[model samples]
Target: MKQKIAVLGPGSWGTALAQVLAENGHTVKLWGHNPAQIDEINTYHTNRHYLPNIKIPTSIKGIKELKEAVIDVDAILFVVPTKAIREVAKEVAISVNTKPYIIHASKGLEQGTHKRISEILSEEIPESKRQEIIVLSGPSHAEEVAVHDITTITAASEKLEAANYVQDLFMNDYFRIYTNTDVIGVETGAALKNIIAIGAGAIAGLGFGDNAKAAIMTRGLAEISRLGVAMGADPLTFIGLSGVGDLIVTGTSVHSRNWRAGNLLGKGKKLDEVLENMGMIVEGVATTKAAMELATSLNVDMPITKTIYNVLYEGKDIHQAAKEIMLRDGKVENEFS
Candidate 1:
């Protein structure tokens, strides 16, 4: 059934998802803060800064006003950064009259509170005006998804019906969506993998071969699973699409902003310089801090995350951190489980 959906945020991920929804026969109100970007999408059907080559569907209308996008939508898909989730949700709460399903594709933990995106949404948006929140995540990259490359993702919600609703909305021949009921596991895996991707990129930037990259990826999964399990998530979820799958793509692919930023840092660029050069949110940089704090607070052992955090924030030498990671006291391979 075709329905009207509001896609908040016109970044690469937002625009690509808007395209997918439009192709799936939904009327999309693609909302962005910048009037210039809205005009570009409305006039040229192209978000040149984000998805430069792909032409967006004319069916996707660009809306600058937040209320205009949410007033009559059946669902709202948030593709904004983690930091902006609360503000956006608050704005939507003021505008929305009828309850609409809230789905977030953004992956990252909040900086100070360390709350997941869905939690932030729940806190900001009144329960009376929103349906069960859903999270859409997996290995897919916006660049590839924009080009019609085959991609698979998970739609997770506390309510199976909600997850199935998102799955039905997004599933197609090129894009596949699987449904899962483990919201905590799904969200934790999604947020934590970006940190591992940074480590993977640093390994690559340091000129390490496939062996080193494999080691980082393996141990990265171990630490990710450790923290996730400690935080009340299913241990097995780490091995699924949102966990191992996302780590592989984000860690190995050039399309990942976190990996790209880590690569620059590994090559000796300063964090500020790397961020300025990338001109986009490198989520892993922030997630590294949040994850490290969470792990420390939970008394979970996450050496890899700790090292990456130090390297990114404390000006620790990357080589020394890598060396320390290699020389850490040995443990049973399945200790995390």
Candidate 2:
């Protein structure tokens, strides 16, 4: 069955998702704030600013106005970065009347407020207008998804129906979607793992071999689980697709922006310089601060996150931070309790 889908962002991830939907035989509207990007998608069958090389399908239309994009869509996939989800959602809510199913692909906690993307949407969209509210997440990366690689992700929501609905829309040969009820855990796992990936990248960039990278990835997951559990997420979910699965993929994959940003940081580049050169939003930088603060407020033990927070925000040296973490560890192996 064909559905009208609106992708509420024109970044790489959003464009990739729109491509997937178009491949699934759905009519897709790819919305962007940039007029040139919208024009590229509409007139040239490409998105020059993001996902430059991939050719967009003719079925996927591009729209600059939020209202124009949301019109008559059966599902609206919010694929904006976490930092911008709230603001975009706010703008969307005011003009949207179609009451389409809300599916979010963003992964990060809001800064200062420490609110999850779902929470932000809850506050922004009217209570009566809230859709099933689905979150799509897992080990999938945008670059791979654009090329029609075999990618698996989980579609989760508090409501089982929402998960099933999203699963039906996104599932296909190269793209697999699993349904889960642990929305909180899935979202937290997806958001928090990026921060850990940054640390993993830093470890890799410091000339540390596989062993060090493995340790960083492992310990980073431990901290992510600890904080997530404290915030009412299921611990077992952390070991599943959205948790450890995502950590392994992002921490090691070269496609991860967070990992690349951390690699430059470990190479001794300043934060501003790294950000400027990358020309993309490194979500983990902001997410780390939000996660660290949230963990502190919840009294959760997140030493790895704390150390990364110091290295990124407080100007602590990466090597010094690693040494401190290495020396302070005195715990039994295979015991996560």
lDDT (Cα, tens digit) per residue for candidate 2, span 1-337: 7899999888888889999999999999888888987887888898766676888898888888998888787888999889898888888788787777889999999998999998888788875665778899999888899989999989989999989998888889999998899888999999999899999889888879899998888888888888877888888989899999999999998889999988888888888898898867888989999998998898888888988999999999898998998888588653144
Cα RMSDs of all predictions?
0.9, 1.3
Q: Which candidate is the best by TM-score?
A: 1
**In candidate 1, which residue ranges exceed 4 Å CA deviation?**
335-337
lDDT of 2: 0.87
Clashing pairs in 1: none
Write model 1 residue lDDT over 106-165, tens digit each, in one string. Answer: 999999988999899999998899898999999989999999999999999999999999
User: How accurate locally is residue 54 in candidate 1, as Cα lDDT from 0 to 100?
Assistant: 87
